[model samples]
Target: MSRTAEEIGRTELGPRPLPPLGEQRVASDLSTVDTVLSNGLRVIAVHQPAVPMVELRLKIPFAGTDPMHAARAEVLAATLLTGTDRRDRIAVDTELALVGSDLDATVDPERLSISGNALASGFDTVLDVLADALTGAAHRAEEVNRERDRLVERITVARSQPGTIAREALQRHRYGDHPFTREMPQASDVATVTADEVRALHRASVLPRGSVLVVVGDIDLDRALAQIESAMAGWSAEASAVELPALPEVVGGDLLLVPRPGAVQSQLRMSAQAIPRTDPRYPALQLANLAFGGFFSSRLVENIREAKGYTYHARSSLEFTPSGATLLLDTDTASAVTAGALLEIRYELGRLGLAPPNESEVDTVRQYAIGSLLIATSSQTGLASQLAALAPLGLGVDWLTEHPARLAAVTTEEIAEAALEFFAPARFTGVIVGDADQLSALRGLGGVLMP
Candidate 1:
């Protein structure tokens, strides 16, 4: 007589402990070539033969002190590549479609960035189009007017958003009169931008002397270099790119309250000074941040979201600027729980500093840190974007390859020290935006600056 199927399943398929993870081997065999063009454009090309596509990134330092610069630059980025000397908008779009390529341009207070990807065989076509836009972008009057109107409308909508209001208020409180506050230009300023003003900003700020170009894909190094040189030969500028002044460190003090009438929810934002990636203690700090509030399993999320149901999400991260870095923590919660949430957040910050992570906590976050870094760089597009982000800091492939080792080498003592230094509650200051009636209870919490 054969045994029943249920009897065999219970006897042979009992639960058992899973095996440990095996050793992981990260790929470090990428062949890279670096060159500086005669006109001072630095190019870095990495050979990645797994796929038949090439990723391109171009970064131009576009900083200006003029109050109207941000609005003008915003318009310039929108209209850039709309039309060039050799191709109108339609022809440009048609050619890019033929080569299976799409490019986009964006501007921030730091730089103007262009990123795209194309078929490996169509690399030359991509470079030519890029060169043409750099040299001959027409900034036609009609396109400029249309884009300006659209930009004004978009800005109006964004300003009405809770997130936008919180971010703008934070910047103003943090930087005072610094140029970084120009990140969110006033709608009035954008409405006044003329086509001629955009053209002038482009002529003055789009030079190549301080720019970087990064390409990653399946291609021969020598041939790619030759193609880039030939395609960009006609693009040159006598002036170097503008450089902004260094940012001042954030001053920590009482929290500032921004009134939002009838708001059902409140946005809680906080910031503290942080060290740059180049700092020796950064690896330990990164792991410490993960254990505190930088990941899903962090103490902040476990306490505020899961335990108390104060919010659906809570996160902390480091933002690296050209001159410095800042640690930011943000979450939104119901108005009824805003004061309680802020009190708990302060408690967690103080706890992290007083009683740092234990050995088990440190080990878990260290593994996550290393694993996430390796996973992010496993694809062509991912590697290209990472390289481009690091280029402004003068970092390259070597930095990316060696960072995992650094993360692994961080000790528990170092993490404890980093927590003590950076996670203290007195080291942070920020703004809270909510309805006055809803946040009247916050005044009793102490250290709130009312507007």
Candidate 2:
């Protein structure tokens, strides 16, 4: 008779240690061609041959000083492709379908972004439709009116959401009167915007001088550049795109409480000033954040979610902009546990600063950081999106290619220093939104800043 399977395995060998990570290798083979058109449109084409599809991203600086600009831009983005001089909405849709393409437009405080994809063979057709909309978007009275009503309805619904309320409250508390606070415009302001105003805003604000276009796919880079140039030649303006003023630096202090009279759950939000990607210490800080709370296995999650069952999720991440960066921490929990969760979160922050990560902790986060970067840029759409996002910051494909090495080079000592500087509990301030009755528990926690 044969020996039992378990007995054979136990006799064969004891438990073995995991193999060490192999030497780092660059996985991306993307080669790019960068060019500028006569009308000042910056075009970047990357050759990625894994798929027969082309991904496109257009970023236009769309900032405005008028308080009503956000509301109007919201409407403009919704109705921009509804109709063009050459094609009504139906015709536009039909043409895009023929090419297996789709395009979407959205505007935020920083830029108006257009992203889409199509078959590599249909790249020219996609570009043609894009150019026509860019130059000849009719902003038809009927389309604008219909979209404006829809926007108001959506805004109304969004305002009723607890998350939206918390975000709006946090932004208001953080920025005060800064234009960035207008991320979601007042429904009343949106209600008053007229179609004519959206048309005029489009005419004045949409220009090519400060815009960037990134195209990625399996195609001849030179031919793609020529096609883009010819297609967008008609889309021009005498003035450069409007650039927003710098965002104010975030200052951290006591937590602010925003009461929601009788809610069952509470939203916890916190943010601290952070270094931009260009900063020399950014890679170390990135690793430090990961070890603290940036991933599922981080200390915050291990403590609050796994150990205490205070929440199902806890995470921290960096939000980058052309002007600056902020590290944000978010979690939601039952109103009863809200105070306890906050206290534990502060404890983790203090622990990270005081004790820092050991060699094993640093190694795990470093591997995760490098691995995530490679995974994010592994596809055509992913690469295109990453490049487009970095373009406004004057970074390019090289930055994407080289960042993994920086993450790998970050030493344990560097991460310790970054943690002591950035992860201190006193470096964060935020708002807590919960039921007023339940928040009595938080009063004893101290450092509560009331509005």
Candidate 3:
């Protein structure tokens, strides 16, 4: 059935009414057990019941200052579960297979994380295996050598990437030689890490004190807590895990030009200070960030990508670091257009602070913020990961459940104020990674430091 042309023509044609936003559904006040054990590990257990499986995240404060710490930490993560006094690699893999479970470990500048999932009934086996490795990992020489080779290959490849180069430049430009700046260790450093060094680092830094373990799934909260306590009983030390030293504040100034000769493209990365999720004003700032560049509909994307075709993508978001929350904006463009892109980016930043978002824009971003959080915490793994991230910041399920209401209560005026104070162009500094020869136009634009 189709309307006649005359009938269609007679109807007033205007924008269709935007659909009403769906109800902002937040997580229920589920029963949770959050407490510290005798060994000083904070354990948080919750029941999601979405499936008969459990998700686990163990985070240990693994920060260090030794120049070689990053290399040894990487090797330790790679070979942590390969063998222990009680079991070898083959036996560990066999038991895990029988339990329908898998485990993986990784390290960054701040912590060592071991993440795993298993069928609810087989969760005990998973924990037992984790306990075995925590107490008795051998860090066998062969296993160490194998993992070290892989790290070398990955490091070599990563160092050659433009994104990695830009990240290193921005990190150094902001934090200097801080341990937090070493997101990736140098390949040369990794090659020298011996099994003995990894074993030593493990003994010194893998203590359960100040660490956290999170479990979410279909299980009795009490039973899960008991099991974690029993499994992690042997993993303790008198000394607490080392925490990273606080980072210096990021101050605003001229952008550094990091020259990469003959490069066909350039990367621009910028940062400014921002409030955390725990702050009362954070809800408003979240919406302001989205309206600025956090989504496809943001002002930054609309101007630089949709209208001017300066870059393929542009993004801005809040990043939580050990120091505190910071706002990061990034984009890449052809070398010839890098200067123009930076100019437009700065113009949009100034406009965001001066003009701010109107009510309609604020409403759209509010809906987005609410919906995204709901989606992020909808599944067991999602909730587990969220809890893991928030635990370090002293936030938990209450914060998760009450966030929607906070987002709903922020007004357009609050959004305007947040935008004005936090999005000012003068409050940022960063680095530009590109061929210096193609970036002369940036000299006239004026916040850029010519190479």
TM-score per model over all chains? 0.96, 0.95, 0.96
Regions of model 1 farther than 4 Å from truth: 1-15
Question: Can you give the lDDT of residue 365 in candidate 3?
Answer: 93
lDDT of 1 by residue, 1-451 (tens): 8977666556455844456866655767889987789888899899998799999999999888899989999999998978887889887788888999998999988898999999998898889889989988889999899999999999999999999999988988888878877886778899999989998888888988889999999989999999998988887888888877789898788889899999999999999999998899999899989999999999999999999999999999998877879899999999999999999999999999889999889978988988888888888898899999998888889888899889989999999999999988888999999987878788889878875
What is the clash tally of candidate 2?
Answer: 0
RMSD of each: 2.6, 2.4, 2.6
lDDT of 3 by residue, 171-269 (tens): 999999999999999999999999999999999999899999999999999888889999999998999999899888889999999999999999999
After aligning candidate 2 to the native by TM-score, how far in Å is the CA of 240 from where it should be?
A: 1.4
Candidate 2 overall lDDT versus native: 0.89
Q: What does the lDDT read for residue 91 in candidate 2?
A: 92
Residues 1-451 of candidate 2: C-alpha lDDT, one tens digit per residue: 8877666556346744456878666655667987788999898899998889999999999988789999999999998888898999999898889989999999998888999999999999999999998898999989988988999999999998889998988888778877777788888888888879988998898889989999999999989998998999999988999888888877889989998888999999999999998999999999999999999999999999999999998999998855889989999999999999999999999999899999999999998888877878888888999999888888889889999989988999999999999988998999998887877878889877644
Which residue pairs does candidate 3 place in steric collision?
A: none
TM-score of 3: 0.96
Model 3 bad stretches (over 4 Å): 1-19
Cα deviation of 332 in candidate 3 (Å)? 0.4
Report the number of the highest-lDDT candidate.
3
